[model samples]
Target: MLYIFDLGNVIVDIDFNRVMGVWSDLSRVPLANLQNSFVMGEAFHRHERGQITDEEFAAAVCDEMGMALSFDQFAAGWQAVFVALRPEVIAVMKQLREKGHRVVVLSNTNRLHTNFWPGEYPEIAEAADKIYLSQEMGTRKPEPEIYLKLLQEEGTPADRAIFFDDNADNIKGAQQVGITSILVTGKETIPAYFANNPC
Candidate 1:
């Protein structure tokens, strides 16, 4: 059996509020304004979809927030949202791997987050058979094409694979492609799911 997982809020805990706080402090912008300007903007979407480079995203966000931080500083603040890996989830993944189930990670994340995560949580890189990012794929979740691409890459039938994600839209997207998906809500949910539904 093939098991696919989402990175953010699944294998790892992240808080966008942390990002808002960091950028607000560094840019001297009000939290409300920064949230309204950058987080809800098209620039962020473009960045996630690999339409823009990191430097370009930094410059655009700086302009939007009326900040003057250098690219390095901006990148640091931008990538500070991740808190830590969910150890239970990682353990579940490792267990699945040991059982000979193929495990893969699929996330709708940009280069900045991807660059920082592997260094901080090496287990993610070590555990998964393969990792797919929206930035690298030029597509994001809830989009059928991205799921199709993964299915093609793995040469696995959609119905034969199981996926878990924190987002409802992404879960529905996976279902649309005929893959069984679980919408994980909490850290313990996935582990419980695996315990109840053995491959």
Candidate 2:
């Protein structure tokens, strides 16, 4: 059996509010406005898909935020989002691997975020057998193409694997691909699932 996990809130805790606070301080844009205005649309998706450079995405976001800031300033706020690693989740991944199950990470994330965390928490790289990142894959979650691509690459049939993700859309997307997926609500969800299901 294969155990697939999502990186962002599932394995590593993150706070978007921290990002908004950092940007608000630097850009003088109200946190509310930034939170409401920052749409995760094509530009962001493209960046995660490795179709745009960091500066390119930063410029687009800066323009949208009405901020007179350089890419460096924008990236500072972006890098501040990671809060900590989720040890409970990592322990489960390790346990599953010890049980002879393949464990991997599939994340819908941009290069900047991906690049930042591995350095801060080296355990993230060690927790999974392989990490499927959207920036390298050229596609992201809630999309059939990305999930299909992953299934094909892993050579594992959908029914043989279980996926854990924090996003409801991604969970439905995995279900569409015929993969069993669990929606992770909080720190306890993963542990709770394993406790109840024993897998």
Candidate 3:
């Protein structure tokens, strides 16, 4: 079996509120307004798709939010989203590997985030046999092409793989590709699945 997992919110905890809080302090934009303006719009998607530079994304965000912060300040707020490692999910992944199942991570993330987290959450990266990033792959989640590409590259059949992600659309996308997918809502997600499925 090939066990696929999403990086943020699954193997590692992420809080967009953390980003909001930091940016709010820097931009003085009020949390609510900042949250409202921080839409995952075209520019955000493009950044994750490796179609734009980090500075471009920062400028787009700044323009949309009416912020005058420099790129360094923006990057700090962006990196604040990551909180810590999800040890429970990491344990399950390790067990899955011991059971002879291959594991990998599929995340829709940008270079800034990609460059930052691995060092802090090295175990999460090490737990997986390989990590797949949307920015590096030039494709993001909820896309059929990325799923097809991952499966082909890993030489894993759709039916033989099970994917866990926090996003509904991403879950649906994996299901559309004929891979069993679980929506991770809380800590019990990965553990409960492993308890019942044992794979």
Descending-lDDT candidate ranking: 3, 2, 1
TM-score of 1: 0.93
The C-alpha lDDT values of all candidates are: 0.89, 0.90, 0.92
lDDT of 2 by residue, 37-105 (tens): 888888999999999999999999888878878788888999998998999999999999899899999
Worst 10 residues of 3 by lDDT: 190-199
Residue pairs in steric clash, candidate 3?
Answer: none
Per-residue error (Å), model 2, residue 71: 0.9
CA lDDT for candidate 2: 0.90
- Top candidate on TM-score is 3
Rank by TM-score, highest first. Answer: 3, 2, 1
> Between candidates 2 and 3, which one is better according to TM-score?
3
Better of 1 and 3 by TM-score: 3
Q: On TM-score, who's better, 1 or 2?
A: 2
Instruction: Residues 1-199, candidate 3: write the lDDT tens digits.
Output: 9989999889889999999998899988899999888899999999999999999999998999988889999999999999888898888888888888899999999999988998888898778899999998898999988999999999989999889999999999999999999999997888988788764
Worst 10 residues of 2 by lDDT: 63-72
